[model samples]
Target: MKVFVLGTGGWGIALAMLLHHNGHAVTSWTFFQEECDLLHRERANEKLLPGVRIPEGITVTTDMSGAAEADLVVMAVPSFAVASTAEQLSRIVPAGTVIVNVGKGLDSQHGYCRFSETIDRAMGGRNPVVALTGPTHAEEVARGVPTAIVAASASRAAAELTQAAFMNDTFFRVYTSSDLVGCELGGAFKNIIALGAGISDGLGLGDNSKAAFMTRGLTEIARLGVTLGAKQETFAGLSGVGDLIVTCCSMHSRNRRAGILIGQGKTAQEAMQEVGATVEGYYATEAGYRLAQQQGVSMPITEAMYEVLYNGLSAKEAIRMLLGRPRRGEHEEVWFH
Candidate 1:
């Protein structure tokens, strides 16, 4: 298979290595000439996925034309860059090429459209789009650590093809799903909750509070997901609760780290600058809040996060505001059929 990956960030580099190892002809893209030159010369993406050597077979470049004849094009850029990358790919990629997005987050610029929809719209539906997401982290995956993820698409064939191309027995596992909406939502919303969890950790809150926060956060995620036409059951799978638990608890989570800084007397700006990485949760918090409002879904946790991240509301005040909300039934099933 000829696979071209856009974005030479950690996730992109990691997947490019995986594909190269799997005997595919792989090419990867970087936005800047300096980064592209460094990858080609050094055969390593030291800035992001350090210690993992880029395979000699992989070609890294800054040219979008590298995607023209590829059988598959993977969009591994940050969520914010998905639209632009998709637009670029649409112009270069061959007709009927499968494009899989491993980027996780809602498209804030497009009314929180999932990556599948965003990519499809960007390409005018000329290509099939699949979203691959789960608890997998680039740092771990780059080192060949064991990880499992789902490939979701409205087109089941596209999902199955992605599954075949990426799955490996020892270190990587791929599951297929038709619930693209659920998978994308799960991947995006958990980041917001992860930020909240990080704030809890920074505030000296113990396991009990964080655990409760995670549980309710899952509920809020499911509610919003269902409201947006996702299967409620998908929230229990790898992309939802699984991803949430890992992101909220793991040290590898940039979102959680940023949230911790914010909780510990740092402004959001200060926290973000300190992290020095793309905190998808920070962006997700705002997009999720607006989506909640537009959809009329009650996402208190997401709302609280939005306040803390954007509206000058302190984390403590947001917590207090949430605790003061009127009580409701704990088990109202929100099934999306």
Candidate 2:
């Protein structure tokens, strides 16, 4: 299969390497000539993905035209860039091309819609959009570490096709799901929770506080997801709780790192600048807060996140707000006889 990856970020380059290893001809597209030149000249993205070498078999370029010939097109750009990239590909890639979106975040520009919806609308519904997401991180996946992910789409054929293209028994594993909404929501909302976890760590909170924050944060995520028509079971799967755990706990998660800085007294903007990478949780927090309000869902953690990230509330105050909320049942649905 000929695969075209539509970004040069760490995740994009990592997937390109994985596909090339799977015996597919891979081409990576970037918007900037300088990044293209760097990848072409060095065969490695040392800054974003340190120590991982890009094989010679993969072609790197700034041209979007190469995507026209791809059997599979991976939307590896950041969530903010997905719409623009999809619009660009609409003029290039043929109809029915299977688009695999590896980025995990909602479309803030389109009512916080899933990336698949954003892509589908951009392409005039000409292509099948599959969200390939989970707990897997670029740094780990690029190094060929054991990683499992999901390929979700409304169309089972598209999901299965993506599964076949990326799955292997060794280090990379892929699962298929028909619940695209659940999968995408899980992947996107978890980043906000990860920010809270990092903030807890930065505040020198112990394991008990972090664990409670993660648990309640997940409840908030699930409440919104179910309100938006996603399956309740999906939150328990790899894309939901699974992705949440890894993102909150791992050093490679930019969202958590940024939250740590914010918790340590830096503002959200300051933390993002210091992190020097796209901390997706920042954007997600804004979108999630809006979505929760529009849907009338109770997402206290997300609301607190919004206060810290946008409303000028301090991180410590946000934590205090979360802790001071009126006590409630662990499971809202549970009843005592």
Candidate 3:
């Protein structure tokens, strides 16, 4: 496969390496000419994935035209950049080229449009959009650590093509799904819960507290996801519970790290500055909160996270408020009869 990855961020570079290693002719693009020159000269993205060598087979470039004719074009930009990148790709890539989006946040500026919808709108519905997401992190994937991810699309052919392009027996595994909505929601909303889990860690809370936080957090995610037309079972799959577990516990999760900083007395903006990366959870929190409100779903954890992120509420106070809610059956509203 001739694969072009749009965006040279950590995730983008990692996928470039993965595809190149998988025997595909891979080319990756960066936004700036300087970044293109740096990666081409150094052969490594030291700032993002230190010590990982770029394969000799992968081509690094600054021009979108370099990827215009590839068999698969992976959109690995941050969520905020999805629409613009799609718009850019629409002019370059031909109408039938498959675009696989690895971004996981809702479009906060456009009624929280899913990445696929953003791509569809931006590309004028010319391409098939497949969403590839799960618990796999760039850090681990770059190191060839064992990981599994899901490839979801309304088109079965697109999903299988993505699976065939990236799946490897040793370190990478891929599954297919038709529920792009569920997969996108699962991947996006987990970051909010991971932030709350980090707050728990920063408060010196034990594993018990973190466990409760994650489980209940999934409930909040599922509630809103179902309201928005996602399959409930998707929340129990790799992009859901699997992604949630890793984000909450892994040292590599920017959202959790940012939350820890906020829990330790830094404001949301301050934490993000210190993290020095795009913390998708910060933006997702606001988007998810608004979506829940618009859909008449109760997402208490998301509400708490929104307060912490925007309303200047302390983490301790947020936790207190969360626990202070009236008791209800644990299974209430979880299972649809």
Candidate 4:
């Protein structure tokens, strides 16, 4: 298969390498000529994926026309760029081209719609969009670490096709799902929780506090996911708690890293600048908060994160607000019963 990975970030470069290794003719696209030149000249992006080499077989370019010939287009750009990239692809790729969205996060510009939906809408619903997401971090995956990820779509054939394109016996494994909503929501919401977990870590709050935050954070994630037409069981799958665990725990997670800095007394802006990468959780926090409000779902962790990230609520005070909430049972359903 001819694959065009439309982004030159760590995740994009890593997947481009993986596809090249899978025997696909791969081309990676970047918006900036400097990035394309760097990748073409050096065959490596040291700042993003240190020590991971981009194979010479993969072509890196700034042109979008190459995507027109691609059998599969991997949308690996950041969430903020998904709409424009999809729009660009709409004019280039033929109708029915299979697009696999590896970028995670809701589209804040479009009422926090899922990336799959955002891409589909941008393309005038001409393409079959599949969301490929899970706990796989770019840092680990770039080094050929073993991990399982899911390819989710409303169309089973599209999902399975994506499964076949990316799955390999050694290192990368792929599973398919019809629960696209669940998968996308899980992928996006986990980052928000990771921020809170990072805050806990920054404050030197022990394992107990972090664990509590994770558990409750998942509950909030599930609550909003289910409210928005996602399956409850899907939240237990790889894209859900699995992604949450990895993002909240791993140092490679920019969201958690930024949260740590914020917890350590730096402003959110300051932390983002220091991290020097797109801290997705900062955007996701706002989107998640607004989504919860519009849906009337109870997501206390998301709310606290929103307050801390956007409204000047200190991290410690956010923790206090969460801990001081009215007493409630672990499960709202059980409490009512």
TM-scores for every candidate against the unseen true structure: 0.96, 0.98, 0.97, 0.98
Error of 4 at 335 (Å): 7.5
* Candidate 3's TM-score: 0.97
Clashes of 1: 0
| lDDT tens readout by residue for model 2, 141-189 | 8999999999999989999999999998889999999889999999998
What's model 2's TM-score?
0.98
**Which digits, one per residue and each the tens of the lDDT, describe model 1 over residues 1-337?**
9998998888898999888877899999889999888887888866787788888888888888978888898999977788988887788886678999999988878877788888999888888889999998899988899999999998888999999999988799999999999999999989999999999999998999899899999998899899889999999999999999899999889999998998898988999999999999988888888888998999999989988899889999999998999977689668689
lDDT of 1: 0.90
**Alpha carbon deviation, residue 42, candidate 1 (Å):** 2.1
CA lDDT of every candidate: 0.90, 0.91, 0.92, 0.91
Q: After superposing candidate 3, which stretches have Cα over 4 Å from the reference?
A: 333-337
Tens digits of per-residue lDDT, candidate 3, 50-158, equal 9998887788888889777799999999877888888888889888788999988999878998999999988888889999999988988999999999999998999
By summed lDDT, which 10 consecutive residues of candidate 3 come out lowest?
328-337
| lDDT agreement of model 2 with the native | 0.91
